[model samples]
Target: MPPEKKDLRNAGRGARARTPQFVKNFRGVKNWKEASTWLEWRQIEDIECITPDQAGVARGKMMPSKKFTSNTSLALPSAVFMTTITGSYPEDGNGFSYPEDDGDLKLVPDLSTLSVVPWESDPTAQVICDLVHQDGRSVEFTPRNLLRRVVAAYARRGLKPVVAPEIEFYLVRKNPDPDYPLTPPVGRSGRPIGGGQGYSIAGVNEFDELIDDIYHFSEAQGLEIDTLIHEEGAGQLEINLRHGDPVELADQVFLFKRTIREAALKHDTYATFMAKPIQGQPGSAMHIHQSIIDKKTGRNIFSTEDGSESEAFLHFIGGMQKHMPNALVMMAPYVNSYRRLTQAASAPVNTKWGYDNRTTAFRIPRSDPAARRVENRIPSSDANPYLALAGSLACGLIGLINEEKPDAPVGTTANEDRIDLPRGLLEAVERFEGDTTLRDTLGGGFVSTYAAIKKAEFETFMEVISPWEREFLLLNV
Candidate 1:
């Protein structure tokens, strides 16, 4: 099971703190509920602290014991307030913004419009306020922040990247089954439920009741659901989000995937974002369609009338090609993710490029003057959107900055290949590690940190023995 779903609700063996006052005040809301309230991206600062005087107002409504010693009391002052900075102060005054399609997930308007009544009136609120005050740096790590930098870079050149992401995944049986192999090995290609052929072409009604809610919920969120087609795998779906700014579209991809998972759970099913949950099945991938528009004039920079004055397009493509290997760690990021990129027909395995080629790494999806663009088919569904968009845009930026020129187009994976992308995650990370120029360009801190973090993950896998090993070797060997 992915650690994301590991129930940390009661991981530790501690009895609920039972103060008579605390119990009375709690009503029945669990501590996790309180914790969840604080999970609001920006809410990690100092909260309302109950004073001696405010006790009367709090006592007026709830319970007696609850008033003297509220359940909110369980939340420590430090726990109530999150410290975003390494030192005594917070990182920023704006507070941490958990980036998503709708910006940070604040139910209320921003602090500029927010009004804080005396927190003493409610213990629960006080805790939440403290949390909000603490996490000032959350905004820095947000997807919004990541995108903002990329968008800003484009503004300098007066170019904006039109980014549309193809989100791929499988809807599977809810919850992880222990009987299934829980080892680190992925892409085993296990069939989820019914014994059905690939892309069974089931009637719309077959999945309508299960899928309609997701589509409608997405509609309510105002997210673009451009295309929703049953993919070439059983119970798998590919959702295409409309193109927007590189960063914003990345945020939308993250949001859409999250919504799909949540909506699927409500229907007593699970949505697997694993690159390739089942072997031989079409692993999910996000093909990023990119085109640069002049920031000032709104002219498509990639457009060409007679394949002349196509310097910017060529430069952009050239940059992506040159830096792709080094920029790959940001794309494929994981060991299991590599398994998704087989010459599997559904996914692009070789790091080749061509004009409108699906089997290659990068494809010029639209060559018309009005709609000229490139589609990066390197990222897996499992990649972190922030890193993915950052790397892709970063490559484009470098390409434009250096006036890089596209070499001979590979045209196909099998043709006399010219362009080469990262072949695997480890291989890509090595390229990233070796490219000091890219590291300097992307900031040494970010590059080193990302490399180190991913290396740790790979090392963790190296330490574990898989169930497959025990199954195949335990007896036979």
Candidate 2:
């Protein structure tokens, strides 16, 4: 028989003990050559060469360590980039024509992202890849590559973007059937987790074992976790990552999601990143804190020499205020994602900017000159971190170029303000497609392809009837 689970109720906490600095294997591998040497040194048996799709899901080939080293060329169908979340493809539309032959795109590994698979029984390693055409042109719509393009844009102006993401998710009871709604998992207290325990020490301790595994897995892969806290919803928790390069942080988030899910399963539960997983509960958000640095001066461009707000700072906010409405589709991608944007939820309904106010989409958090930044509260947890960061940074880049002034910052809570954002996926798609500036900035091909994919997903969702409709519309409407 299995051993009894340890009692975690009221376990000593103020914050759980920090993840010990576990030395990571293959942490210094910078190329396939180095990867091969490390594999041999550590006796790694297999390697997973993967890439993040438009939905931020890992897609690619796994092979024996020898095979991975012997075969330098790896390829996957170009269609992989165009496929929707439901595994369906959209026919040619919006200037994006699906190639008749479904040509292959080569997978070029980004060696910096290489790390060990801590959960695997056999010794294994995984590295992220970038897709490129047969002619070597980068796939514009690929999530990671898209972020690279945006980062390159910043580099061209002697600027670098630093971003920190606060990712929130929920741990739910293991449910095999999709026909039923998800419920919170029972904690070490042997009772179903309850809501309104935000920031409670005991609240986070309730799932101590699972949280411990999360930290262990993250440390094994060299992923940094700045803080962890219980969120407002039952069984919901948030992880804040250390601030760093946007691309690097996006890669961490991509891998971290997989790690979280794996750790949850180890504890006989499921971890979900859905924006609005449960009804009447607060939705999860991936609030991104962002700032720009002048590469030459090695100083934050958002602040002046005297520590006052700079023109670049206001312009960045101005850009977001102007363009973020169109980019909302990328941040909140699914039909269910819109459920989290309601006024009753702890989410912003409008694009109002304010100082340290949580009710607005863009908030200027209080920090020192070096740390001064804007927190974009619009993106949901389910968003593709790569696409979300790219969208937010792209808007700020345009704002810098236009040098436009933002409206007066809202002093009071902006919760009562009008809902300026799109109400649903279809509406958001329409706004995204109509914005030529954003389209041109974030590759036209990418914008059109993304819009098409989202439209297809929305269409698929419409085919299903929710229980709410069955309950009310079946008899009354």
- Model 1 RMSD, rounded to 1 decimal: 14.6
Q: How high a TM-score does candidate 1 get?
A: 0.67
> Mind giving the per-residue lDDT tens digits that candidate 1 earns over 54-141?
0011111222322312333222232112211111212222222211332221111111111112212232222211111133442222
What is the lDDT of every predicted structure here?
A: 0.57, 0.90
Question: For model 1, what is the error of residue 433's alpha carbon versus the real structure, in angstroms, after optimal superposition?
Answer: 2.6
Off by over 4 Å in 1: 1-143, 178-205, 305-309, 412-424, 475-477
Best by TM-score: 2
TM-score of 2: 0.94
- Which residue runs does candidate 2 get wrong by more than 4 Å? 1-28
After TM-score superposition, the amount by which residue 241's alpha carbon in candidate 1 deviates from its true location, in angstroms, is 0.8
